[model samples]
Target: MNLYKEPLSRFLISYNLCSQRSAKNFVKNNEVVVNGNSIKDAAFLVDTENDTVIVGGKILPQVKHKYIMLNKPEGVVCSTVSDSHKTVYDLLKGNFNETELYKLKCVGRLDNNTSGLLLLSTNGTFVNQLTSPENEVEKTYFVKLRDSITDKKSYVLKAEKGIEIPPENKSPAFISKSAFIKWLSDESLEITITEGKFHEIRRIFSALGNYVVKLKRLKMGDFILDETLNEGEFKFL
Candidate 1:
């Protein structure tokens, strides 16, 4: 964005090619080429919107922003790269190859033990806006409880009355948004929330003297998880 007048080294850094110091070194070493002309000056003016910038031997591909809706499977972390656990990106490895251009990030994360609908995008702005609490983006989840609450109506009433969630690091307990609860069975139901606190659903249930046995996201804003897409499968939107 607005990269035309920026310095060559700054441009490459913004594109995550390397750290600022590393970018300067890359330029100084004559490892960067602009429009087929090799340039060693890190401060060389660039027209990134139009002029091609090449590193090593390949031209940096212009990012064609991608939006993906993945049916995240249980045991998969919602991250681009990880050292221990399997990540959602691993499921999409073969679909796209331009990692430098398209750095897809999950809009919001699902717990590794959780499964279901997850949204990812190459556009950082879109992800920020969609995940912002001010936007009040609603997310729906299907949860299986370890035990029945006996009276679902009471559970709804308690939630509607507002349950106070413990704050981080000894901060004051704050009341989170009241969830819209819909029961499918004695121990299964859907809960919709506009907030994205850490382990929010599990915490909510825990506060109510219950435990979540299984959790799966079903809907987010205007998009619903396609039942046709099996776990770990994804489709572009």
Candidate 2:
């Protein structure tokens, strides 16, 4: 029988038991068992088909990874679980009949106040590839403004020069990569960027003397928000 191995830590993360760091710590503490023997090494490998891994007295099996597209609604946090506010996981919990399918995680986050296309998955590698800052995966959003950007020409110029991020409490201010902005209306526009930063679109508009009243993501890489999905709804990719 030809067998393959995935590190114990990686498997635990991909299995959605915990984060990679937490999984490693769990192994180092001698909590994981393989073939009835305790293994304290995170690097211990598992044969996908044959080896039985037991965690908390439950036997686990290898499962095929799944990609899920969710139409995230505003106000829901993009975490697996949260103490307050609804989580994206809450939207999925009752929808899936399969326990394995219910273990999906957000690929990248949608801020609590921002809504629209969101991707979730049971596969950790896929999540890492898309979320890595090095990849520069394109993320596009539709923004509505409280203060209209009346100066279209000035807007283009400032955008081309790159929106300057103000220094946070005396830190040196820096310029961000030029963002692609297209006007959808006098007060609404579509913006695209490869980088994900905290409060990025709002900051960009604020720097330009405009206010972002609402924001919704429309696309990321090859995935688009399914118009048919009501807020907080999802479908498999």
Candidate 3:
């Protein structure tokens, strides 16, 4: 009975039915029907909870959102579909049917080699809120450097002061605020950052003239990775 208004293009994207560019085209071609009426405007609002949407003549069921936490292994990619490697979604095959699983999307992506806490959810708002840079959500990682620590005090100072992201890095230029770094040993440490820059942890060490031997996410905001779950294992939250 309640209305859940969402733009047609965004709904298509959230449903994984089409990419942003294609969604517009799909709508323009009248391939999408909402409540038995062919909708051509991509910006047209539809009720996600109550509207009956059909794409390519197939009904799109409206289902409740689900939240998931996963201990991602090193080899898995953060993608819905991948031709070369296993995706994070593939790990959920045992828990979800095709329709539900396809609706679930990664909250924030972890690179193919980076292992640790990965969040998956069907709630678009939840994913957007967590990943938005403006939210200043804290993400902590356990890092192992390739070399021994020469000066613990200096490393902490540089990281906390905000390391200058290199020009080559695709992430935004500004580091939001100070990061917290705790040295566990000469080669291992824990760093917490509020910004989700691409290869952020790795780049910080690289700017300090070091290499990251390993990196694993430990926490994101209030959601911490469940330590009990083994690599590649996931549980519904």
Q: Rate the local accuracy (lDDT) of all candidates.
A: 0.82, 0.79, 0.84
* Top of the candidates by TM-score: 3
User: Can you write out model 3's per-residue Cα lDDT over 19-54, one digit (the tens) per residue?
Assistant: 988877878875788998989998888767688989
Which residue pairs clash within candidate 2?
A: none
**Model 3: residues with Cα > 4 Å off, grouped in runs:** 1-63, 169-176
Pairwise TM-score winner, candidates 2 and 3: 3
Model 2 local distance difference test score: 0.79
TM-score against native, each model: 0.71, 0.71, 0.73
Tens-place lDDT digits, model 1, residues 125-212: 5677678888888999999999976799988987777798876554456787878899999999999999888888888888888999
Model 2, 154-208: lDDT tens digits are 7867876798887554445668787888987788888888888777788888887
| Per-prediction tally of clashes | 0, 0, 0
What TM-score number comes out for model 1? 0.71
RMSD of each: 7.9, 7.3, 6.8
- Per-residue lDDT, model 3, residue 46, is 78
